[model samples]
Target: MGSELEMGKRPPENAGNTTQVQNTPPNTHILGSVSTQTVDLFNPPSNACCFCWCCCCSCSCLTVRSAKDKRILMTVSEKQEDVDTNKMPQLTLEEVHAWGESFERLIKSAQGRVHFRQFLKTEFSEENLMFWLNCEDLKKETNKTMVEQTVKQIYEDYVSVLSPKEVSLDSRVREVINRNMLEPSSCTFDEAQQQIYTLMQRDSYPRYMNSSMYADLIQSFEQLNES
Candidate 1:
């Protein structure tokens, strides 16, 4: 009775079969171990080798997971690029002729903004144009969370008195901005934008119209039209 109990406790008489199974690939052993841990047999763990055909047979979960990770990374990269693009103003020749006609016409179009910004750069007042453009961009944002973040960034970069790029705003406007900052909104910079716009129209616009840069650009346009 003792011998029978010992034999029953021992493995199968096909000792060679047990040895053969033990000689199986390491990944198979890992798969079996993972299976015992309540892991979904259909979905292998991320650490598993995706190329191991025998161990990962019919299991494309790792491959799918890898692709999904790559897609998410790509999406984040694209969003970062968009943010950088937004921070810098865009220019186009969509209405180049209109811009060349008058300073008012030039300031109204995207191309005009680019040229005007170049002139402002020389005059050391480029912050005015940058601030105005940022305000315009801020107005188009509908996401409440994004609007709040953008408002803060604009205030820090162009509205704050300590900022190197700070626009020339009066004490009243500055006080209003400071009060509004406690509860920032998309329209927080409206008065500031209006003031800057008026400053450019009255001050910078006339100077730009009379500047050699404007005259040269107009001459080039006429030459192009004639050709």
Candidate 2:
């Protein structure tokens, strides 16, 4: 009973205030006067690392998977062993004495080869003996593919000028290797092997014979035998 009022839809309480329509995307909600973003932890962004919760950079988990792919892509035969050693069996007095008789005898003995290699290392000529040993292993290969791979590895290690362990070889032997490279067989390195063998026999073998390394081994063996 104040004055007669117009009978119409009542004005919204907020009519006096500006009604703002928030342009929020889907899955968003307004709570009170604050807007908070919610993330679907189940579906993270592309750059996010699943391995580490806080890490966003390219991570080791992804790199390890890539390494696994590379390993799988390589043939089992072509892959080198991750760990290897040149260790030989324990030496014996008989083996030590035989080393003095002839270079061939020394080369045939595992223990002798180990000691001789140590001697050659001091002379910076170990590659000659290493080349000879690799050829021995190469000659044992029956598979054509294995022969080819082994040949290439030996060439890279001992025949190539770029190699730190490149062995000495005459022009004739080198030319022969270059010529036979196209169709390699187990005996592809025979000439190179023989050249290195002869080189070791003539030069390094005598020096190794006179070295205290050989003398000490012989003395230790004799002493051990006496004990």
Candidate 3:
């Protein structure tokens, strides 16, 4: 009988072909093709096409951005609604009586401020009170840009000699303000505000307290209260 190996195995003539097939891995071509096509998932290409896809086509990212925009729009809309709803409160009889009791008390109230402004308008010295009120409002502003704008506005309206609405301020105070304007601040008009405050306190307050307008307003308040 033939040898067991010789009977079971292929002949030497085909052995070379069989060996060559066995030495090559089953997925060798697949691995070579895959390596050439391999993508780096962690470090994507920084092309405009990819960027556009990320910004426009990525649903999760777009959703987050759109939600942020909606929130901003909603906030602005709510602020506008609040401003629209904020009408001035009406003056009441008790408020009028409290205001009548003292000049200090009168200037503190919004209603009293309005009435006092009207009184000042008649006196032709309304700019003084207006400037003081503007300064007060300016002090309340927290934004630097807005503060700067307000300072400029106040300077033009009340400090400039050429302005018809210029408030009466001494040369020393004007000089100080001019220097302060170089580095404008919320308190740029502080000295001027104090001067005007004193002017109103000394000159306008007593006269306003004793004026026919005051008497008439008091009478009106009483009638309104009685009714």
Number of the predicted model whose lDDT against the real structure is largest? 2
Give the poorly placed runs of model 1, Cα more than 4 Å off.
Answer: 1-97, 100-104
Per-residue lDDT tens digits for candidate 2, residues 112-222, read 675676666566566677778778877888977567656655665567665666677777888898777767788888888887787778777786787766665556445
Task: Report the candidate with higher TM-score, 1 versus 3.
Answer: 3
Candidate 1 residue 57 C-alpha distance from true site, Å: 60
| Candidate 2 or 1, higher TM-score | 2
1-227: candidate 3 lDDT, tens digit per residue = 13211112122332111101112333222111211112111111111121232122333433333344344333321221121111435455567678767777888876577667656655666667777877887788787766665565566556765466667777788888878877778898898889878878877777767666566666644543454
- After superposition, candidate 3 runs with Cα above 4 Å error: 1-86
- Between prediction 2 and prediction 3, which has the larger lDDT? 2
Could you report the Cα RMSD, in angstroms, for every candidate shown?
A: 32.2, 35.6, 41.3
Report the Cα lDDT for residue 118, model 3.
Answer: 58
Model 2: CA > 4 A from native: 1-90
Q: Best to worst by lDDT, what's the order?
A: 2, 3, 1
**TM-scores for every candidate against the unseen true structure:** 0.56, 0.61, 0.59
lDDT of each: 0.54, 0.57, 0.55
TM-score of decoy 1: 0.56
